[model samples]
Target: MTNSRQKIKKKQQDVVRFLEANKIEFEEVDITMSEEQRQWMYKNVPPEKKPTQGNPLPPQIFNGDRYCGDYDSFFESKESNTVFSFLGLKPRLASKAEP
Candidate 1:
């Protein structure tokens, strides 16, 4: 049977492949926080440290890009242009302006 760590690793590898095949560059962001650590931070950290509606935690800062959520969400958003930039991939520019 595969362990949780192994499962996570496989997911990461798949993400890498998807980005490569699509010619979409991306930097791997590690946001795997331990359950205990997260709980402690939530309980002990000052209110200011806690995330608010107007100010979100800056997406996990990687090489340079800001990834706001799980890999799947990141994969879907065009705003993830920053991720592609980090991977040294070119951005797909829209040819026409919206009406």
Candidate 2:
């Protein structure tokens, strides 16, 4: 695989890992296999979010019909400890330990 393809695959895997770890339910669509689904994703993505040249890449996330953004946004949310919110999920309460 090409370097860019490898990076995309890694990013997709990372997103899946985080979602699974947090027990978030999501559907994975393989655009390469389904042109219709790929077109749907392209149309659903906000115009501002779409690339100027090519169609938007994979790992495009959504909560139901709501767009949650791509890998970079996901990584940012993870770093900021706001992934649950980013995924349109209610934040889980942090448990307190007895002193």
Q: With candidate 2 superimposed using the best TM-score fit, by how many Å does residue 77's alpha carbon deviate from the native?
A: 0.4
Residue-level lDDT tens digits of model 1 in 32-89: 4556534433444346544675332323223333223444444565356565554345
RMSD to the hidden true structure, all candidates: 10.2, 3.2
lDDT of each prediction vs. the true structure?
A: 0.50, 0.90
What lDDT tens digits, residue by residue, belong to model 2 across residues 25-90?
888888889889899899999999999999888789999889999889999999999998888999
TM-score of 2: 0.89
Candidate 2 residue pairs in backbone clash: none
TM-score of each: 0.38, 0.89
In candidate 2, position 72 carries an lDDT of 91
Q: What TM-score does candidate 1 reach?
A: 0.38
Model 2 off-target regions past 4 Å?
94-99
